[model samples]
Target: MKDLGLIPEGYKILVTATVQEEDCDGLCWQYIHNEDKIKPEFVVSTEPTDGGIYRGHRGRMEIRVDVKGISCHGSAPERGDNAIYKMADILKDVEALNANGCEDKDAIKGLVKMLDPKFNPNHYEDARFLGRGTCTVSQIFFTSPSRCAVADSCSISIDRRMTAGETWESCLKEIEDLPACKKHGAKVSMYLYDRPAWTGLVYETECYFPTWINRETAGHVQAVADAHKALYGDKRIGSETAMNLRNRPLIDKWTFSTNGVAIQGRYGIPCVGFGPGAESQAHAPNEIIWKQDLVTCAAVYALVPSMYKGKGDEDVCQFRAGGTDTTSDKSAC
Candidate 1:
C-alpha cells in the first residue's frame, strides 16, 4: 500500500515482532511500553482470531503455592509432617474452588460468581460476556532427602485465568483464604519472569496478565469491523476446509489471552484483534495457517489505519482488570 501510495496521510503503521510472548504473555509488550515508550493510539494484535474481530478475552497469571514441612524417615510416617499430604488437602480446595457453583449458600463460591451481579457488582455484565475465570493446579514439585524420607517441602504452580472484575491481588487472596491453605500456612505469590531473551537481554516482570475488553462500538473496534464488512461482507470468510468452523459471528472474543493484556489491560490503550489462522490451531501438533486467510488478514489490516476515525479523550476501555503493585523493571533491556 505504501508503494502504491494508498496509506493515508499523517498515519504510520508499525509492525512489532515482539519476543518472549510464549514464555510469558505480554512480557514483550511490557518492555515495549516501559522501555521503548512507544505508545500508539491503538494496537491491533495479530494473534490468530479465526477470521473474526476479537475485542478481548480473559487474562491469565502464573501463581505459586508453597507449603513447608519437616522431613523424617519414611518408616515413621507419623513422625513427619508430610508436605505432600498437606498439599493434597489444598489441592482438593483448589478443585472445589473451580468446580463449585455461584450459589449464595455454597461453601465455596466458584469463579462463576464473576458472572453474577451480586458477587461481581462492578463488572458482572462484562464478566458474563468474556466468561468466568478459572484456576487449576498445573504443576507440583517437592524436596526430600531421599525417596525413603518424608518430603520436607512441597510447591505447586497454579494457572489462574482472570475474567472481568478479577485482579491479581484478589486471585491470590482467594487462595490464601482457602481453608486448607490457611490451615497449612501455605504461601501464595505470583511468579516473576527474569529469563533472558534470544537477544540475551532480561526484562524482569511479574506474571500477572490483566484482563481487558473494548466496547463493541469503540472507534478502533468499529474500524476493524467496518473494514471487514466492506472487504469481505459481514460474515467471516475462510477456505472451504475452514468455512464450517469460521461460521460464527464476525465479532467475537478470543478463548485465549493475547498481548492486549499489557497494551490495553495494563496501560488502557485502545486495542483490537483481527488476524489470520484459527484459535484452535494455536498449540496443536499439526498447526497450519491457510494461505487465503493470510491474504485476507493482510488486506483488512491495510485498510484499518485508513478507516479509523481518531479517538477522543473519553476512555475507550469497556473493562480493564487491575494489575498488581509490581511493576516491570526493564533496566537490562
Candidate 2:
C-alpha cells in the first residue's frame, strides 16, 4: 500500500480476504457502511482467471430426477415395472439435453455442459441426489435388495447448474426438451431435490461470467494496456496476459461452481474475479502458480489503481484487464 500511496486515506480501504459469507451477507454488509456501519458498493474476488481480472459468473442450482417403478424377480422381469430401467432411459435425456443448447435470458449463455466428460458417466450408472445438491449425480438407489430381484423403486439425483438469473424450473425445462426425457416418463422437480441459488448479482455467479470483449478503440482494457506500456515502455510487452492457453477459446467459466456462490448468492454486491492460478490447479493435488506469472500478477495488483486517470471518483474502482485486448497506450492519470 505504501508503494502506491495511491488513494488519499480520508475515505477508507478495508482489505478483505474472504469475499463470501462465513456468516450471512449481513456481516459483509456491515463492513460496507460508508458510515463505517453498513453497505459497501461492490466486492472484488481474487479467484484466478489465468491473469485476467473477472467480473462475475452465472448463478447455479441443484436439480434432481427420481424414478419409481415396481419390482419383479429376475426370471419374471416382465412382472414388475423396473424403476432402474426407467431411470436408465431417462439418463439418455440428461445426455441429450446437453447435445442441445439452452437459451439464456442473460447475455451470458450455456455454462453447464452436459457433454462435459466429467459429468457424463463411463458406463452411465444411475444415481440419486446427495444432500450437496450437486448436479453431478453422487448416488443412485434401487429398493428391493437382491441382485436377482428387479428394482422396486429408484431415484437419480443430479447436481444441476444454472447461470445468473436461472432457476430450477428453467433447468428442468431444459431437461424436458430431450425426446428421451419425455419417452422415459422422466419427472423433474426441485422438491424431489433442487434448490436454485438466488440470481442476484450480489457477487459473481457461477453460472456465467459476464464476458469482456475488448475492442480496438477500447476503454478499460486499452487504458490498462497503456499503463503497462508507460511502466515498461514499448520495449517490454505489458505484464497483462493474453491466455495463450489452448483452452482459452474453449471456456472461461468453471465446470464446477466457485466461492462466487456464497458472495453472489447470499449477499448483494457487484463483484469481479481475478487471480493468478488456472481453474485446474485449484483444489487439486499438484496446485501451483508459475513464479514469473505470479510476479506479473503482483505487479498488476499493485499498478491497477494508478493506471486509470478517472474523470470522476465513481470510476476509481472500475478495473478492466486482458483477453482479446487491442489498444495502444494513452497514459492514464
Candidate 3:
C-alpha cells in the first residue's frame, strides 16, 4: 500500500512482530507497553480465527500446589507421613471441583459457578458467552530420599482457564479454601515466568492471563465486521477445503488464547481478531491453512482501519479480569 500510495495520508499503521509469545503469552506486549512505551489506539490480533471476527477469549494461568510429609523406610511406611497419600485426597477434591455442578446441593461448587448469576453477579452473562472456567492437574511430581522410602513431598501443576468474573486472587483462594487443601495445609501459588526471549531479554511476570471480552458493537470490533461484510459478503470466506469448518457465526470468540490477553485484558486497549486458518489446525500434526484465506483476510484487514470511526465510550469491554497485587519491576534488555 505504501508503494502504491493506497494508505490514507492521516492514517499511520504500525506492525509489531513480537517474540516469546509461546513461552509466556503476552509477555512481549507487556514489555512493549511498559518498557518501549508504545500503545496503539487499538490492536487487531492475527491469531487463527477460522474466518470470523473474534472479540474475546478465556484467559489461562499456571498454579502450583505443594504438600510436605515425612519419609521412612518402605518396609515401615506406616511410621512416616505420606505426601502422595495426602496429595491423593487433594487431587480427588480437585477432580470433584472440576466435575461437580453449581447446584447448592452439590458438595463442591464447580468452576461452572461463574456461569450462574447468583455467584458471578457482575459478569455471569459474559461468562456464559465465553463458556465456564476449568481447572485440571496437568503435571505432578514427587520426591523422596530413595525409591525404597516413603515420598517426602508432592507437588502438582494446575492448568486453569478463566472465564469472566474470575481473577488470579480468587482462583488461588478457591484452592486454599478446598476442604482437602485446608486439611493437609497445602501451599497454593501462581507460577511465574522469567524465561529469556530469542533476543535474550527476560521479562518476568506472574502466569495469570486476564480474561477479556469486547462488546460486539464496539467501534473497533464493528469495523472488522463491516469490512468483511463489504468485501466478502455476510458470511465467512474460505477455500473449498476449509469452508466446511467455517460455517459458524460471522462474529465469534476464539477458543484459544492470544496476545489480546495483555493488549485488551490487562491494559483496556481495544482489540479484535480476524485471521486466516482454522482453530482446529493449531498445533496439529499436519497443520495447514488455505491460500484463499490469506487473500480474504488481507483484503479485509486493509479496509478495517478506514472503516473504524475511532473509539467510543460505550464501555467497549464487557469484562476484564483483575490483575494480581504484586507487579514485576525487572528491567529487560
Q: Among these predicted structures, which one has the highest TM-score?
A: 1
Candidate number with greatest lDDT? 1
Model 1: per-residue Cα lDDT over 229-278, one tens digit each: 88989999989888877889899899899888889888877899999999
RMSD of 1: 3.7
Give candidate 3 misplaced runs (Cα > 4 Å).
Answer: 325-333
My TM-score estimates for the predictions, one after another, are 0.95, 0.57, 0.94
Candidate 3 lDDT over 250-294, as tens digits, reads 998988888888888888888999988999999999999888888
The TM-score between candidate 2 and the true structure equals 0.57
Error of 3 at 185 (Å): 0.8
TM-score for model 3?
0.94
Q: Report the Cα RMSD per candidate.
A: 3.7, 12.1, 3.8
In model 1, what are the clashing residue pairs, if there are any?
none
Question: Where does candidate 2 stray beyond 4 Å?
Answer: 2-4, 18-38, 101-139, 161-166, 176-187, 191-256, 261-268, 283-285, 305-333
Error of 3 at 281 (Å): 1.5
In model 3, what are the clashing residue pairs, if there are any?
A: none
List the candidate numbers ranked by TM-score, top first.
1, 3, 2
